[model samples]
Target: MQRYFIAPEQFGEHTVMIDGEDAHHLLKVMRMKAGDEIIVCDGLGKSARAKLTLLQAGQAEADITEWLGASAEPLWKVTVAQSLPKGDKLETVIQKGTEVGAAAFIPFQSDRSIVQYDGKKEEKRRQRWSKIAKEAAEQAHREIIPHIGEVHSWKQLLQRMAEFDLVLFCYEKEGGAAGSGIADAARSFHRSRGESQEASILLVVGPEGGFTSQEAEQALAGGAQLAGLGKRILRTETAALVGLTCLMYESNEMGGA
Candidate 1:
């Protein structure tokens, strides 16, 4: 079934009103009419099965049939704090990261980042990134769409480190060393959770040139654990996904073999 993320207010006692882009996609693009069943999510984790009762140009309505219980979200909320990379690599990260169970994304400027920050076009770029996340979430059957944060400077990103329960800094220098791996970190995080089932994690990936020693030291001082992906060096765009996948696997969000 096709899934659509609707606002909470748009949902009635047992009905949901789909409008604007979603409606157009359902009514015209998908050619969905009355009696077609679709899944509706609030993007805040609530979702339900609905049968379309009305379909018109730019508007559609569906009667809720069953509230979904299973969720595609990870037990721990993993936010990807990615440094600006060259070209459109950030877009690829956002799209694939969302599918890999990232709860949010924070794009920041690092010391060795090749792309310079452009404040004038940030909003437009953010909108495009958000759209990519949303589409990826829908395709992956995620209960919530991953959030895209505004571009942050190195200092700004460091200041927000305290917000997360754990921060894993992906540094190339840690490869093949005795440093912490994402699984061990995730396991430690899970053990320390005590009564809480949910925890927030910030996975920081550097740019193409990777994080400098000074930056890595600063991150360690800011309460981040330096971790490695594997023996092979990964592109800046691939690090976030790999780290996120490892975290998910360790948390048992990924199915057992």
Candidate 2:
């Protein structure tokens, strides 16, 4: 059965309407017929199994055959507060980050970040990232789309770091510290959360050149524990995905995929 996300408002008693682009895809692209089965989700974790009752121009009606509760969301909520990288990097970050179940993405300008964003450019950046997140979520079969928060300065990032329960700032300083790295930090914190407990993880990854000493120290002072990804360095785009995958896998929450 095909799966599509719809707004909670569109879900009604016994009947549901899926119109617009989705309808067009179902009717034409996917060649869905009247009796075809489809699953509709609210993108906020509610879902229903429906059989197509009617198909028309910009409209596809169905009956609610069954309801699926919030069964698709990740057990851990992760927020990636990444330093703004060079051109096209942010798009990759948002798209892959969404696939890994990040709840939010924070783009910030750090000391080593060469890319500067003025007010106007910053708004456009957010919009583009938002689009990438939406498409990634749909393709990954995610029930909720991760939010792309506005670009921030180092000061603003520190101010917001206190919000998450466990905040981790990827720092090379941990390279010198024995037995304390990103993998270690992630396991140390994630292990404390019993299965089914509601917890949030905030992982901060810097730009192409990585975080400066001052920025890393400040992030630590602001409540984020510092950790190094590993001995071999990674690119800005690679670091986010690598670090996140390690975190999810270590926690056994990647769910066999």
Candidate 3:
């Protein structure tokens, strides 16, 4: 069944209203007609089986058949704090990171970041990034679309670090030696959680040039545990996905017993 995320307000007790781009995609692109089945999610971890009951220009409606079970979201909420890289790399990170179970994304300006933040196009850029995350989540069968944060300054990123239970700084210099690996950090976080499953994590990945020594020191001082993906160095875009995947795997979200 094709999956589409609708706002919570758009979902009635027994039916969901699909409008705008989604409606066009359903009625025109997919040629879905009345009686066609689809899954509708609220982008808040709630999903349901829905049967299309109405289809018209720029609008569609589906009747809820049955509510879904637990979502595909990871038990541990991981947010990727990625430094802005050159070109459209951040889009890739957000897209793949959503598939890997990252709860959110925070794009920051690092000292070594080649691409500087442009206030003039901030809104447009953010909207594009958010759309990527939403589509990726739907394609991956994720009930929740990852939230994309505004581009933060280095200091702002550091300040936001205090919000998470665990902050993993992916430093290339650590490379399997300088800091605890993802598995160890995840296990320790799991143990620390005790009976609660509401833990949140922040994984920081630097830009093309990676983090400078001073930046690394500042992160370390901010209570971030330095983490190494492995001995090999990964591109800025690859690091967030790799780290997220490792964390999800360790958390047993990847079907490990």
Candidate 3 has its poorest 10 consecutive residues by lDDT at 175-184
TM-score of candidate 2 against the unseen true structure: 0.91
lDDT measured at residue 86 in model 2 versus the true structure, 0 to 100:
87
| Candidate 1 regions with alpha-carbon error over 4 angstroms | 194-196
Best-fitting candidate, scored by TM-score = 3
| Reference-based lDDT, each prediction | 0.90, 0.82, 0.89
Which pairs in model 3 have colliding backbones?
none
The segments of candidate 2 whose C-alpha lies over 4 angstroms from its true place after superposition are 255-257
Error of 1 at 251 (Å): 0.6
Angstrom error of the Cα, residue 144, model 1: value is: 0.6
In model 2, the worst 10-residue window by lDDT is: 248-257
lDDT tens digits, residues 1-257, model 2?
Answer: 67787778898898889998889989999999988999888777777899999988899999998887657667778888888888898888889888887888988889889898789777776787877887788788888878788888888888988788898888765774666787787677766775567778888998888888888778878898888877778888888988788777766776522
For residue 232, what is the lDDT in candidate 3?
Answer: 90
Per-residue error for 17 in candidate 1, Å, reads: 1.0
**Number of residue pairs clashing in candidate 3, backbone atoms closer than 3 angstroms, sequence gap of 3 or more or interchain:** 0
Q: Give Cα distance to truth, residue 131, candidate 1, Å.
A: 0.7
Ranking by lDDT: 1, 3, 2
The local lDDT score (0 to 100) that residue 164 gets in candidate 1 is 93
- TM-score of each model, in listed order: 0.95, 0.91, 0.96
